[model samples]
Target: MKKLISLLLNRLTLVLLLILAQFIVLVWLINFFSNSWQNIQIALMVLSLLMVLYILTRNDNPEFKLAWVIPILAFPIFGGFFYLFFRAQNLNMKTRNHLYNVVKERQYILSQNIDYGLKGNYKKIETFLESDFWPSYKHTNSIFLPSGESKLKVLLEDLKKAEKFIFMEYFIITKSKMWDEILEVLIEKQKQGVEIRIMYDDFGSATKLPLGYYKKLRALGFKVISFNTLKVHLNFAMNYRDHRKIVVIDNKIGYTGGINIGDEYTNSTKTFGHWHDAAIKIEGDAVWTLTILFLENWRFSTKEKISYEDYYLDYKVEKPNGLYVPFGDLPLDKNHMAKDIYLSLISEANESIYISTPYLILDNEMVTALKLAAKSGIDVNIVIPGIPDKKMVYMVSESYVPELLLAGVKVYKYKPGFIHSKIIVVDRKVAMIGTSNLDYRSLYLHFENNIFLYDASSIIDMVDYFIETIADSVLITPQEMKKRNIFYRVIQTILRAFSPLL
Candidate 1:
């Protein structure tokens, strides 16, 4: 009874209830007006038809369009009203202007100091990223971590070396052994007068961290903010989340990948069998790019105008020679940069393509690219989780297996447990590792970050790790997929149809 009461009083639950009540009221009013007024009924029907037309004309993913169109066609009144309420994708104007000013003011100054000597296809990739405002760097050293436990050890050691400020942004931050150990170090660093700031997604950490956790951090003199804080009302803005995991120490070292702040990442707790993940540690001029990514988010969340000079490291550090292009994707931007990068990598692969992701929901464009690559006799392999964290999403992911298999794309399921790593390696010469998952949300709806390496030693390391993981994974056969029941296939089709919303 106490647990039930606690759940009912939870902030997320309360907010959801409030939103549900509002939706119910809206539906009730629509029905009442339709019965009482012929004009109102005709007007609502016309609005729904217009909404369907508008959705079809908008340049959006077909799956996303279909998800809305089917519902609107079924329930004209309420569906049109809901779509009208939630359709706008713009950030608040003030926040958008501030972000643009921050980037515009620093773009040239930051780009002038680094030179990425690119050749052949690497040059082409660099040029594309530059055109999209993601600059390539030359002086950064990249270290590909194969597991979360390995990253945590290196992260702690790097944290101990911080002299000035520490910035961390993650999708989820839970109060667990992993966070407790990191927090202890952060608290000690605070005593030494080192500045610290953290940003975490409210929706991601809703069930893990207690309410007012950010307030407690602020009281402790740590600058902390929740990304898109949840409210007791309907909010379409809440759908776009900050899903990037970034840590920058003193503007010299940075880390980003699939790992979040939880014991599961470390494989200390067996929530999903053995938890497998990956991260990349970067040092040198490229770290500054990550610092900017964090600051842009901080400025937006806090509404603070920041001088770039305050956190920018003026001195250059000697690092290994390679091209490291760290980039970000914003829902406000029309360019789907991350997905485009993945598609290009697949299309450009000459020898082999290896990928690891938690989810495998691909749109037609990506599927076509991969299929073409495989049909051309390039080795194409993908690894996903054997144990899933979300069962419905897992079912949806499985729905794509048969078509990909028929197209000659090889798919593997890690036999040990869930693999949360987001990595792609092509031809053993180019690789990308970071927070963007291979799904509609990461590609279309979330703010994400990734690093692409050209001719970097990390590419070889990533390839080696992929081979090792494949040894432990079980390759899926067409026969195995065909064994699924007809009822299950029907469910999968229904789930896949609406996967964009999932």
Candidate 2:
């Protein structure tokens, strides 16, 4: 009872603090404009009008559009200009040109060597690739690592064997014993002249890392770049973070997915016991794809154009018949690739749509699509975290479960710990594994990525793993939900109302 009160009070306090801060900031801006001899208020109103029009024409989301429009409407003089200076996605022409050139060069090489070999039995995936994503690169092997412990062991081994270079980028790299071990290896590799470049999101790791984390790494001969530094002035830019966990070693080995570099993922320490997560480490041609992703973000931060040719490797042996195209999903792009890929899989699913995510908040389209799939007799199973780090999000996710269950969807709560893996396997043929959560922020507001698999090997592996995971999960039946306390259900309903913001 005390814990609940504490949580509620903390939430209330946080809300009050935010409102106070916003009011003070707005007042200060208004006062400054009023006192200015330049008639800044009149100028800002005009700028804000232009900003609103630009946002209205470009962004289609009603929620986000309202978020911007409301502020500009309330405080026409300052809010509009403030948005123009910060909220705009207007990329500099030079940056756009650089991206175009890089993409063109990368695509040209991909065309010559790689072939999308979804020819015979993989026709469904082929249509998905071309129509949805314009996927042209192929003949890549993708392996799924179901257990976090298993993935961590293999990743450590791969890091040990890296000879030339190791490119590491993640949203979180804490100063734990796990990271200490990795740091030791990175330091040793740096001393040996192996090119090491580390990139991490500043805000994500801010509390966990010391002030001079990058400086320390640089001192050890490691090239480190901090993505989007922390400052109130840069808050708008900070929202669009590099949430990718990509590790490319010697341009031959690569790893990516939901797992970050921490003891929790390895199950060595139990913050939330039995941490469930997934990741993939790829060798051969796929590593090149990840290296490019790292280089693009690295260049954006450091302004150092690293050569893709240097990282590219030539495989002499006949590779496995798996087509892998690793693409980065950007907020700047009009098309939502991650959502589109999942939607395509859901649409083409004949038997089942299995998903496991920490966050289950969805837009109207996704909610409608899932309901339709469940009603059409397609087995749609969604596994969410039982013990969520954010209790409100957990409640919000649960609120949606009953409706899906009513429509023939099966929902499971991971009884062991937080289910952090974002995975989807469609009809045992298509698989999606990545850091993207099925939430508005990931799909629309933030940059995310996923690896789409076409082969039967990984799809079966992922499906089997999901099945085994359910053994430790509690199936949420409607009868059981009916027995829940009235107070608890009310909390869930209230939490779900704010699901869109989540």
Candidate 3:
């Protein structure tokens, strides 16, 4: 009870309340004038028409365009204004161009000289290479981490060996057991003259960490940034959050996946019962890609020029593993990079597809691709949480279950607790593990990161782990979904309609 009250009184709470108050006032004023003034009503109607026409021509998901069109027609007076208010970028034009320039300069990483005999997967890999400007590496060693606890153990051990610098970026980080242990190691390493840089999404950490948290971290002799700080304003820029989880040490080793720096991730607080998550470590040649991913974002946030050559190191791993491609999905980019990779994987898989994700709010393209894969007699399985972290998102997931089940796609609910991992293993030969969920937000809205790996021995271990998790899950039959009453189904349908916005 005390904690609840304290949270309610936090600065984030106060700022949110202020934003809500402003929104309500704006809506009230618009509604009042639209009813009273003939000129105002006509102007708003014209605005609504223009908005609908503009939305129709956008090169985005058709479903997303339909989602917006519904509201614009229903509340013609306020809907267009609301759309403009939310879609407008808060950042100035100069800043936007600078962000673009930084990424543009890193385009060289998209091409690599070293090649491999990836016989039939050239088209699948080329999407990341040409579209997103991410290279596929040939000589990197990777190890699969099955759980957050496992990642933490390996991460702490690796952090202790940081010789030059450590770059850490995540969507969420709170003051907790997991963070404390990592911070202790980081502090000791900083004292030893190892450079430390930390970046996290401000909206994700706003309530958990105090205001100006980065300033506090800087005081402790670390370079830190609270990316996209939460402001009491209406802007779509806040929706484009940095949802990537990365830990790059000395440009020699890197770690990434669904895990975050929170006690719940490590199952210490059990915020969502037994929290299930995963992360993987890449050592040798490919770690450089992870390092570059961090440095690009770090430069964008900090506005500091980085000597790319200074961080370059030719790492050598004994008994090196298979091909690895670490890439990030930029919300600002025209192409839906991660979603395309997922589609290629589903379309190319000849045997089976195993997936575990916390959210399953997919776009039409993904849904169709999955259904086709299942209909082709391929073993298709998706494991979601029995206990969800977000009920609305969970219901949105449940809304898709009926159609998916009918199409022969098997869906399972993990019985133990909320499974936060985002992983896809195809044909026991290729896998993708990372922070991008099987949801609209991860696919189209948030900045996300994931690794595309092929022919890695760890792929088998990941598949085995997914199979073990399926054993602990309950399969959702078609008849089982029929048990939901009318009211429950209606609510789910409503959530699904606006899911793209979420």
The estimated TM-scores of all candidates read 0.95, 0.83, 0.96
**Leading candidate by lDDT:** 1
Q: Is candidate 1 or candidate 3 better by TM-score?
A: 3
Clashes of 3: 0
Clash pairs, model 1 backbone: none
Which sections of candidate 2 miss by over 4 Å?
1-25, 28-56, 66-139, 234-237, 316-321, 479-500
What are the per-residue Cα lDDT tens digits for candidate 2 across 63-125?
567667777877887778667645665455686676566555555644454445545344665
Model 3: ten consecutive residues of lowest lDDT: 113-122
* lDDT by residue for model 1 (273-347), tens: 999999999988888889988988887777787876799885465657577889888887688888988988998
**Which consecutive 10 residues in model 1 have the weakest lDDT in total?**
112-121
In terms of lDDT, model 1 sits at: 0.87
RMSD of 2: 5.5
Measured with C-alpha atoms, the lDDT of residue 381 in candidate 1 is 99
lDDT of 3: 0.86
After TM-score superposition, the amount by which residue 400's alpha carbon in candidate 3 deviates from its true location, in angstroms, is 0.5
